[model samples]
Target: MASENDYINYEMQKRTEPLLGVVIHNDASELNANEWREVLINAPEERYVQGIAHYYIDRNGQWQAIDTENIAWHTANQIGNEQYLGYEVLESLSSTDEEFLLNEQETFRVIASDMIDYNLEPNRDTVKLHLEFSETECPHRSFEIHTNWKTTVDGIPDEWVINDLKDYFISQIKQYMLN
Candidate 1:
């Protein structure tokens, strides 16, 4: 295995796009922040990686990732990958509803903190889901929780349903941002 310094030096690339805001995703695994970090930092290629997101949240709490300025290969959309910092909530698919809620809520708080730090207001434009830019059912946990609905078609969330999730997330983030 490669040493920590052997990969993901946070110097491999720099963001040329104007920093937009935050893009949220799910880790899709049961691993916590540290475990996910190990997986990502050691991965030999971006295609095989889970994340190097700016933050990871689990029931244990939130880990605001160390590298803030450089680009991370989280969002598949090139613009989002460069302009928006990504946050991963531990697991949506594997975790029970109760467990997922705990992790999701914790993610909200950390995102709120990052928003405040970056002077971003909580809204649809500032807070985004991975699915917003792609066809995947990413952030599936939040999609189900906020909309109380599932995919109507192929695994892709309906356009309006994703909006609902974004609204719910923004509201939650606002609650934390104010406090």
Candidate 2:
């Protein structure tokens, strides 16, 4: 009852709306491309959750991208899921800060290239974080590595919000675009 091209069909999860922005997330685990591909296909347990991770940087510091034409069920919100590509940066399994930062930098470079292809600019509107769409701590490692903010009494961040993260990522994307 299913085929490999089932999701590839335009009627399935294809992107209908014009390309808008990008949502950055941290996978929180280290999985290879084949492992990630399997996760993407079988991880759609939640209702209508596509479970697709559109972009990421492998542990080898290589940028990887999935089906960009299809709408990734990444963002919990429909708007983001339909309009933007969700990028997942592989987290450091050994908790190495430098390795994680390097992974993020590779991701940023790929994202910057995608922005150029989509004719998008590095700004608040075009750059987004997973926390903005839902209450998840996605992009967590990225936030922690880039900023000194830690969880507060609310069990979430206080001083640093999505804007701070967005600004930092936007600046990074901009820097990559210059190279």
TM-scores, all candidates, are 0.84, 0.80
lDDT of 2 by residue, 39-81 (tens): 5543334623545557656546432334777777788888888
Candidate 1's C-alpha runs over 4 A off are 1-10, 46-51, 64-66, 152-154
Q: What is the lDDT of residue 107 in candidate 2?
A: 79
* Residue pairs that clash (backbone atoms under 3 angstroms), model 1: none
Q: What shift in Å separates residue 155 of candidate 2 from its native position after superposition?
A: 2.9
Root-mean-square deviation (CA) per prediction = 4.0, 4.9
- Candidate achieving the largest lDDT: 1
TM-score of 2: 0.80
